[model samples]
Target: MAFFLWLPALLLAALSEPAAASAGTSICNDTGALHQLAVTARTDGSWITQGWQALAPGDCTNPLPEGYQGRFFYFRAESPGYQFRDDSIRFCTKAGPFRAGGSGDCAARGYREQAFARARISTDSQKIPLSSRSQAAAAAPDTDAAGGTPYTAAVVLQGCSPEQEGAPAACRFVGGGMEIRATAGKQAAVPAFAFLMTLQQGAPLAVEGELISSFGSHGDLDLHSAALRQPNRHDRLLRQMQGRWVSAADPGDSFTLSGAVRQVSYRGSAMPPEFVSVLDTCHGAGTAGDFLLARDSERGTGLCYRIQSLGSDELTLIYLPRGTRLVYRRLPEG
Candidate 1:
């Protein structure tokens, strides 16, 4: 959701760090939306939790009062129609101005327990972005670099399970991490369907944030593996084969190809698309695969196809080497 930023009148005093040598952290609302802030921290030896720090877009606040000392702190931020999910940690909160003494049973003392996220505080007043944002986390591909129209890669990951109770370590366990071709960027975002058009033939990629992420699809292990699979050719044939495809001989069997190939099924049973890319030359079909389709980036790794027809209605790709045909028809989107 988009929010407009409103600057408070003559608000210079509130946004600045205290002139005296600082001891607490400074948080800036870079998300462009207002968020209700709550914090839990170890101050003086007692676990002190406080809240309702109204953070307007672009506004900054110390959150904690002066004389606060700690290497770390925690907070829960909520905008009117938005939720900033950081549930690996727990803290207590109450409606209206609240001051809780301990991180214990809240219901017994008229408080509600809510999950919070932790942040490392610095002795110096360093600015930290309290973000729950909607920026383009996916990098854009240049036409020259990706061999197609400019595009960006994007995916959404749902890590925090709402049914989960308390702070479970399982919530943060995202695995050894993922490998992805795309990086975070800010050029025009591409349609999810056009994701493949943005892939560079062979460009540099970095493993960032351990997001699907650290670029797996929504953090799925198989999906992330597929994202690392490079497409062999940037041809028109590749574009034509971009959506869900079902076997024309048997409708229940199908698979989808995009930035990653997935949702595959055999005899109506779900299966995995172990390798990535569908190209004209991988299978050594000298005439450019109007007759055959290759499923993997490397030859002899996946099913090879013999194309009978494309575009009109039923598209046929007869598996070569094995001589099995999987004629396909485009599945209409429901």
Candidate 2:
């Protein structure tokens, strides 16, 4: 069994698991082992506990659609025959997936009280090295030549059951099937990439590996073969794309470049935030915009983007995988 290390970016993600999409939070289980997570949080002014995110090693889960940054979130992860129970902080959790809470007697409410770890998250760049013995991690490079198998339509996120088999591929068959290799030398895009079926229609979520999987599409895909797609320009975000951006395609589908945590927040879209784990400060950073659109400054993992053009008030992005162009107009920051 590999080690389970928590990325600081995911520490605050477990907070207040709201019933609606508002509970959007992304946490990674790069511990090199499978982990089942349970959380106790306060949502909509009420305390709630949600659980069983079955995160595989090197994979992450975004339970909600939108990202939230407020108070702390609590959770516990357990693998087969192994778990870390924080006997100090206790919460009620079931054996399977569930959401429950609001001050109650464990037994009376037909619930069992379990301990949870208080995950302290901050926008600052701080990494807690969780333990790991996976040789693949020790031998892989941070960034290398990627892309072996071409990715087409069809998306498959690590489902409820993530198989640990023949070197991770872009998308594996539901039960047991052939592994679709996407890219090669993609140290980061292996068994760790979580391909959730969250695309809206034929929306394209392009990564370095040409992973073109989306709704209504079916095929084996490979994510492990590619790294962040190299943007056309090595330049950074000019004028610093802050504030809200209204999609030219659909105004209802907008994303906000939060200056607070350097985080991206989305609305009315199945796709999660483009990037997270950026610096809280907008100014005084070297690698902030080096990747053209942006990359996770803290961990360099999450999905990145390629820039078409950035005017004083507009931004254009290209979904390289499908050759789809997206334009956005910047709205005044209030």
Candidate 3:
């Protein structure tokens, strides 16, 4: 997220004798999806960049020196004294300028200072390509901390089955994975941080309170977490009501709700002229009642309740079958 500005010191130059123009169809002009290429900064100054292209338009009106073979373009303000690791150097070739049409623009706009002159092909399943560099610069401070990578780590779900006994379900890394590396001053080290397997597919889960600060082989960074539980039948029913509902006409003379409702009222009619009576009880006028119907401790056909009466209090639902009235009590602060 930083930038460096330098006065223009170089201009495009024309080449006298161009290297033999590749014949028999250049790989850059393929019609299929532009294949990815691997480009490493070679110890020699031959190729210092790597990128992709489905159909490379013939050389620019003015190309670099006759042997100026650089293809993958990269730039960073932090070099020399600073260092970098876990940096991504791959980019997709596109039909238009800078592969703008693809889902991901490898180097989000405005970050280019130097451009590649040539690129080499990759040998992976994707048939990627890469460009080489002259000499490996001393590791520089990581300048691309926000870049998303295709790398993923292994994670295992644990403590959810009946045998775990009271332990909250948790997802944890079960195998070795890449570590984020960072440095400030002369101190360079890895932290203890784990990546949520869920993030690999790009599903949005927890953002805050999920990242373990400074946790991992490299400097600790916030990590993503996984979804632990799904909504149950009662939760689904409550959602259907849109947070509002009324008891049945008879209410079974003493019925209990299968799910939480926003309001509960009794309407009765009686008398010489048939007068109507309205009974308003527990819970706010437009707010959900204090408790949610839950499975009983006995785990039988009956129901129990879990109350959410006070903020930050564990819900404890109490089930009162037909013809039962339970008293509400509050204990004094100790």
Candidate 4:
């Protein structure tokens, strides 16, 4: 039994402390699409939440009347057909132009809770620019110091035979993320397989001998390979649990856990596991000390889960509310 929690658009705003004093915050939308935005900030010793502000492509919001205070501001934005980007902070929100008084017990207080992206507002800076560009670009391999084209991560499946062996691959930065282009013949000569390719920026050129591996008959595959660097302990533990996992006591109770750059997915028999689409942004925390924030589409409520322990072939996760421990064993790969 495989269960899945769907997380649509989970966006987060980048924060920077510039040496300038401005009246209010100016939000700019750099993506070529419309975005519905929301925000939460602390003012007058209380947290205020407001929302549904819409922005057209290449447009900036009117300098909101609120001035910058030395505190963290939260924001959320989403396109018509995409997922909402949030910072894993929970705040109250309503449908129309309305304000919520406090951030506590939103539901009990007759307000709806929604996740927000957090931005620390220093007294000096007053601008928040939002874009739809690939966040992965920051982590992308930089060009050689001599000014050569940089490399980006990519994957090509084994079964996807190229129409022309050395034909140029299409590379572009799109909404979902960076995409690598390749021409595959209509027919697959082998079982469904994939190869991770390293792409050069600006051109669709792939580095030779950059193939990662071939997965036979696997469904959708997300390949993430950064330049050769020290492996993260938590990441290594997560990778060890990627395949099908079953409960030690019950075979019928099982799930599949997969991970990517800053995200993780779990599918199993549970009722849409409380946490779906866990985004890892809290840095500096070690393997078993990191925090995972959940972004659920149906319920915009923000939830946080902490990793308790991870061992060889087994993992332990504690649900924050009740401290429920879920231990799973890795199932043998078929």
Candidate 5:
């Protein structure tokens, strides 16, 4: 869903620290000594948990937050503790060494509360409330009457006014957290794909709510990781692939090739005489559509092209390494 930013005309304020200084603790910061944790449950009733702390800001030696607060880390919780263990209590005091008692809610599971200059805190909504109409319909005796179990997520942005805009905007639990309609008898809780897409491209993000597990797609993770590494490569690919190329000549016109690798062509010819092989130049094999060709004088490869075209509509691209050029036009859309 798309939303335009429209706020009462007011002077934008600079991001400042909390009104009151915090002396509490934070487990969210990467380098803040407190370890952030992640637990993932698989489809086959299996799970994996990973924990690590992110790098801290300014002085790495600055005392870590003393209590449960702050946006210094990314926290993951599903069913509070049904599938994973809860250790918010130990985290508040110990800061480093922590242990999980058992599966429990965020508050009941032992998170500390204090008056320190904290960042953000998690909330519990007990249960998401359904509309009277929805509740009544759901009670109609037929299991399917209720909406089928799909990972449904309702994201609401409160304090949306500019006050908290750039302050690592928080995604704390709201209205009893999230409500999920599960398939009857399924042991797994559907994963909700939820994250705050910010105006800043690489600004850090944190989430402190429970969502269905389906939202954990490895494809998104891999793409995000790759983007962080070679950002320019992806940018170039996106730009070059979106070019609105105008065909130089109609395929119907009789054409003759005189370049290094010459081939004759008449109107509506499917194959081009010269093209640079994308595989040798870039990532994959170059094909007829949207290809750049190059020939080596000393090397005997007759014709080749960089495969700058891919997909049903050729949206992805394979470009020449550099200093290489291939000329060709796309087939006109019928």
Candidate 6:
């Protein structure tokens, strides 16, 4: 995971104002990991670098002394055993806590030229948020090497069975093998007769019976088994996800899915595509309407998209935080 500095710059005129005069830039550690911080800034035609400031998780420095009155400040941070880095802006730095004068000719001046990320001071003395690499990366967009949209469509689950006896209805194959009933609505308690079932389209009767016997036992059911079959479940999802999807309301927002790897390439009015991989998927422990966890393969960080409803052609996903529900339609194969 890489470290990120959220530096919102404060205008120079704002600095002279009463609010800015009393305010200074502060860095907050929003990640669970510890970090070592270094800062560089240009003041009065002289570049100065100071570093080796260690901060524990959730700790922050006091306003950094407002050492220089500059519009932009550069920062470098790293976790132990990882390489420390900044943004594209480069400056000279040392291995330990030390101050250096002049930013040019770093090698000749016995200093190392290192890249730094710019951090802007806010007028209201707001703290700059620093997140763990994984968190920052997850917020970034994904793109393919060819610079083309990877996926052509997206599908979300739709329609789930209603609850019964306060035990929550189990997902099952119904309607003369034409429809599937998936668990939906609020989460329900685990049933005493919990079972997992899978029904693939056009499967041989013998195979289907065997699956039913293996997965169907008690009266209750595990919804995960119906939507996510074992033995290459992730791979299966990856295959099903090979298409493009657009936000129903926001045409500018879209997602392109491609590759054997489970990843999502998002492009819209927000940011550039940086290709994010889907690391793994985890199921809940016998809970009805349990969240299906999808993680980043590289950083092991990801989001939990609630499986509201799932079927052969349509999928309904609900993000609880922002109350965002996305319904995706599968584009016909060409």
Q: Identify the leading candidate in terms of TM-score.
A: 4
Better candidate by lDDT, 1 or 5: 1
Q: Model 2, residue 251: displacement in angstroms?
A: 37
Which ranges in model 2 have alpha carbons more than 4 Å from their true place? 1-26, 62-69, 85-87, 124-334
Q: The CA-based lDDT of model 1 is what?
A: 0.46
Residues 195-246, candidate 1: write the lDDT tens digits: 4334433221211222222111112111221133332333345446657877
Per-candidate TM-score against the hidden true structure? 0.34, 0.31, 0.20, 0.35, 0.17, 0.32
- TM-score-best of 2 and 5: 2
What is candidate 2's lDDT per residue for 1-334, written digit by digit as tens? 1211112222233353333331234556667665556666667777788755545666555433144454676766655334353536777754333468764686476456666666555454333222321223333421111222233222212222333465432333210111123422355553334442222211212332332321111123444332222222221242256567777766665666542123333343233222222221222232333323232322222223356577878887643233356788888877
Best of the two (2, 5) by lDDT: 2
lDDT of 3 by residue, 2-91 (tens): 111000010011122245443211222122121222223432543333222111222111112234344432321112223322244333
Query: Cα RMSD (Å) between model 3 and the true structure?
Result: 26.3
Compared with the true structure, all predictions reach lDDT values of 0.46, 0.41, 0.24, 0.42, 0.24, 0.43
- lDDT over C-alpha atoms for residue 29 of model 2: 66
How many pairs of residues in model 5 come into backbone collision?
Answer: 46
Q: Write the per-residue lDDT of candidate 4 for residues 30-98, one digit (tens) a residue.
A: 766655567776777777776555556566653234454545667776553345556667887643234
Query: Which numbered prediction scores highest in lDDT against the true structure?
Result: 1
Evaluate candidate 6 by giving its C-alpha RMSD to the native, one decimal.
22.0
**What lDDT would candidate 3 get against the real structure?**
0.24
What lDDT tens digits, residue by residue, belong to model 6 across residues 1-334?
2211100011133344443243577777877766656677776687778764555667666434456567777787755333433467877764333467767887577556667778776666667667622143332332111122111111122223445778555443321101223343334423311332233332111102111111011111123222223334433554455566554554444455443222333342322222222223222223345343433222222334565655556656654333346665554555
